[model samples]
Target: MEATPRPSINIMTALLLLSLHGFIGPAAMAEQPSISADQASLLALKQHITDDPEDLLSTNWTETTSVCNWVGITCGTTHTSRVTRLNLACMGLSGTLPPQLGNLSFLAYFNITNNTFHGSLPVELSHLRRLQYFSVRGNFFEGEIPPWLASLPRLKYLFLNANGFSGTIPESICNVSTLQTLDLSENQLAGTILPLIFNIPLLKVIDLSNNQLSGAMPSSVFSESPLLDIDHSSNSLSGVLPQNICGNLPNLQGLFLSFNQFSGGIPSSLSECRQLQVLALSVNNFSGTIPRELGNLTLLNGLYLGVNNLIEYGSGGVVSTRGDVYSYGILLMETFTGKGPTDEMFSGEESLKRWVKNSLPDAVGDVLDAKLLSREELTAAKLECVSTILELAAHCCTELPGERKGMNDVLAKLEKIRTVLGQM
Candidate 1:
């Protein structure tokens, strides 16, 4: 629900609209000569909302007063007083838009958020080529996303979230090359998210969450985009997410694909996103052990993966504490060796605990912590104590639950090792 960058206003368009005052015919003479293209559009907008209980438009927007004097209207001080920005957010206005308002040639920034405006967008709005930022968020605007918006060259920010927009997200929207932010969440937009959106060079934020967009999102699209935030959560999107998403999109800061049906292992490549601040993949079907590499993202602030099949989700048929022992063994290996059971190095029958157990006694030096090796001044007794600890860890992580030492026995053995180390 982010507001995007406002478009730069065209001063020349304002001047041209003002000069039209001299060309007024005898019939147009009845109308005020000072009323420019934007003022006329404002009057059409006023007509739609005057029937509301607020009477906001009828009270202030009148011919007796200059449009420049109206509320939410900002006119240029240079040559012409044509309106450049019209902000009427949270006004509680209710009605449909008029086609006449598209005549605002100089209009650049228009905000009508937090209103009750309904009905589909007018085709006439396509005439506002100078428009850059147009937001109707928190309204009841419905129907298909108009394909005509692609014709606007200067349009950079389009916010239509929290509406009733339906039908396919027209591929024509990708035609707006200058677009920097597009928010169409919280609607009924169906069909696959067209990949052409990735071509938008300046696009930084894309919130297509809370819709019906399905199918696998292409990871290759992230390779070149400088996207700062991507929220595709709360949808029905399915399929395995490509593992290279984090590596491909280096500048990515936030990635939200939660509450979907995505199924696959948590990508180990996610460790490459050094700048990632938030990664939300909760309530999905992601499998495999949590990648220990994810701990590498130093800047990561949020990590949500609830209700997923990380370790276990649904019933695993017969349950036992043996699973706890298995988890404990994995944790023990990961804690000391700093490698997860699901790490790329451990595949097929190989695992972190198995590897540590294999190199016991003789090769304990090879897998032992490098910091422990640095303790060169230590006596041989301490080294023997370290080997005993490794053996205890291996015993806790035996392949069979029946063969593994019970918790009480493991604790007793740990105490014995502690006593031996403490005496030295």
Candidate 2:
């Protein structure tokens, strides 16, 4: 028996075989595709918009990648991928919304506010059944609001302020029982008030200011809800305000009815809202004396009742717009000291601002909320910062409205105080 000889191989032949094996390796790759509906939507958005020349989005956004790893996209505990939140706020995105965004079935939050997006809101948004928050304020969006939005079951927050939206608010909005915040201010919406909106039990904040809405204010707007804030200012609403405005809303924090045609006296029953903070009823036709009971609101912060036909309840006590100025000061104190107006500092007719200004040297700790004293572990510098804020509040709440600082001024001063506090 003779042995068979093996065939000889050259170096080039060996390299050719290696190359063939390498080509087959990719076939066995086990990774799933990373492209998601959200990614596709983002890509479409990038293509449609002319802004963001800095490539900020491209740097952090990619398809075939985990959306949880992408910027501004939050995920849940299970890490089951979904575009739960999309915060493109102030990103300067200048384009119309793409309808393909509806593909994100699990998206709960979508905020493209403070941008330059124009044109009508996409009807495709109705497909977002899980959407809880949708804000497009401070934009150029025009045309009537899409009626299908009423079908969104989980929608809790909807802000379309500072836009060009016209026509009456779709009555279907009342169908969203879970809605907590609804802001349609600074729009061109006209017609009478829709009573159905008052029936939503969970509504907490409703701002319809700066619109053309006319008619009597709805009586049952806050009847059965835990609404804490309501702003209907600068509208054409007529008739006297409901007497039991605060009677129903036990937790009412702010009530802004300024620049309207509301008539009658400031209701004494409003004192029942122990948690009342900001109350602005300026530029209305309110008459009669400023209720002495209002002074009993311990939690009151900003009280603006200027340009109204107000009188004092007690003899020799003249009602002045300065009361509002004093209230603003109290608000500043509340912000700095973290205390309500009735909290020890200004318990009686002795205004907080007056006491602090008159006794500047000795008044440093005089206006400090006693609540902060319990936290004895805080540093001395921190305590001084608190004192500085109280002094600043004193300056803001002067006896004259003209002398009292505006919100911008107060905020600037507070920022400075904050910066100093941060250094400490």
Candidate 3:
């Protein structure tokens, strides 16, 4: 009787079942219903990273884990897993980014900031049609930014700063019509910045500072961009600023144009930047007195007018903006009061500092901007805040240059004021 001739020859059913379910091993995962293209793409990126001392990639990205379960990889949940975000910023990961990263066609945010990754970007990265935020700052990446950069129609928020990238930024960079923030700062990039860069409608920041960029910022470039921040500082860029630099840019917030060859008066049009929070025009060839119109930038919070050829303004016999601490003090006084030193009310003997100083401590209401006094909510806490700042400003503008507080003292006091005011 024995064993009933062990069930046998079920090959047809086995074959059918295998076809329905497909392969499931780690090897088969390289293909079909198991691990998808997105997984393989990420694994390829992980392979190039020879040293991730933190074990971020090695411990998390393994066969037993779903790719979505791995750190630094976000996948869409609605469909089959597709990588959407890959951020390994400041992770001490070192290696080249291989072209396989392009296979993650659905990735939108990619940042490898503050790593030691070297070599040029892979051209295949352009395949990431959905890429929006791409930053590789503080890396050793060199050579021209990949030519395919222009191909990503949805690309915005590119930060290639603090890298060794050289060569002229390509004209095709303008092709990324959705670009919002373009920071090519602290690179060896040369050649005149392409004029059309400032024409991109969605651009919010243009930071080409500390490059070898030459030539004038084109007037046409200023016509369309309508950016919120522009920093063309520390370059060889020369030419008078456009007369209406702030007209088209109604939302302009920060303008840093220091340490260049720009020679001319600070444009009277700067008064038009009503929302400007900072105005840095130091170490340039800008001569003549600062335009009286500049005092109209009521929103200005940071003003760096030092290190220029402000000949008429100085202490001792020598003339220099740096030595003219009194003028800086006056500038500070005007900033808080929203009144120029030469306002019509200030007569031959009267001055902005003197007016504020006389009303100090008890009568802060008389010196602060009317807009500030109008806050209505400034019960006791905020009014006390105002008194301190104005007092500091008045101290900065004391009669003798030797008597005035040093800038470092002023800076520390301002930071204290900001902290006390809960603005820091």
Candidate 4:
């Protein structure tokens, strides 16, 4: 018969009820830290971005938006809703990273690859104990790689390549037991590689190429490691390669040592790496006949042995390293075609050997350099001699190193060809 009288409350009681029911406006809620530490850190980074040509962060990342919804920001869903991953790769965003980024205690994966971010990496980054994958590749970041990076207890992949980072690679980085791949290529890093780097138990790949590193390789390097790929090319590393290079490295897949000052005979034990797919030893000062045992590497696909001083076995024996045959084949092709293995005309799958091998028997004239023989000098006898040399080279370039021709056979055939040419 009567509606219940509405209860009256004081202004303070009304405000308390609204707050308890979450009916208060953002202006009131903002009084108690609406922005999180993660948001603040991200904002600090945004302030350092001098150029955001794509407006990726400039437009999407704002205080009005939820930090988790921002572009390139991924927040955790299962547990605490904190920033867990920050990936801004290839956005053309130019900026130096802010030290406040270390405040993202939950950050796990961080990548800024192929951007123009420059300046030394802030030491505060070492605070990211949960970081798993950290990459800053293809940027202008410089200064010595900080030793504090080893402090990341959970780091798995670290890519610091294609930058201007100078100074010796910090030995302490090897302390990361969880590191799987460490790529420091294409930098200005000098000094011999630290032996401990090769000893990390879980390390699978080590790329130290295209730097200024010099000095002999550590004697204990590569022994009993699980490394699958080791690239030390385009450096100043000298001294004889270890005779037992493939020792205990059952998983070795690629060994790139090109464009260095490495000398002495290639280790015959390289044949032990049955899984080896690519072996690059070109542009070095290696001498002595290649070990015939290399032919045993049945899985080898990419073999680079050109530009070395490898010669016929001084013993004049029929047995020669299988690698020597491949080198000789490449040499023969270069001599006739005047094209180096690194010729601009050759790249990717197309190589000097492949070019000559494909042109053999019928299209010999096509591969011959004009400097090698003038049109008038290209008589039938001369053409036959040239063809024989190219044929020998093709045999040396066989896909399987073991299946390639021996140097003894190659030398004899070459001598006979010369004899015939001289008589003609």
Question: TM-scores of the models, in the given order?
Answer: 0.66, 0.67, 0.69, 0.70
Q: Lowest-scoring 10 consecutive residues by lDDT in candidate 4?
A: 312-321
RMSD of 4: 11.1
Question: What local distance difference test score does each model get?
Answer: 0.76, 0.74, 0.79, 0.85
lDDT of candidate 1 over 1-424, digit per residue (tens): 9999987769876555655865434544443444566677888888787455566677888878889899888887743666778899888888889998788767788899978899989998888878999999989999999999999899999999999999989989888988999999999998887777876888889999999989887766744777888999889888888777765567888888877899989888888877787777866898887787987898775565654667632213533344444444444554456565445787521456667778776666667665344457456776666667767767765656667676567667768887987777
Top candidate (TM-score): 4
Model 3 per-residue lDDT tens digits across residues 357-410? 887788877677864556576567777877787777666656655666766787
Cand. 1 Cα-lDDT: 0.76
Query: How many angstroms is residue 252 displaced in model 4 relative to the true structure, after the best TM-score fit?
Result: 0.5
Best by lDDT: 4
Residue 399 in candidate 1, Cα distance off native in Å: 31
Lowest-sum lDDT 10-residue window in model 3? 26-35
Clashing residue pairs for model 2: 34-64, 35-64
Q: Give per-residue lDDT, candidate 4, residue 264.
A: 93
Off by over 4 Å in 2: 1-35, 62-67, 76-80, 221-223, 313-397, 400-424
Candidate 4 or 2, higher lDDT: 4
Off by over 4 Å in 1: 1-34, 312-424
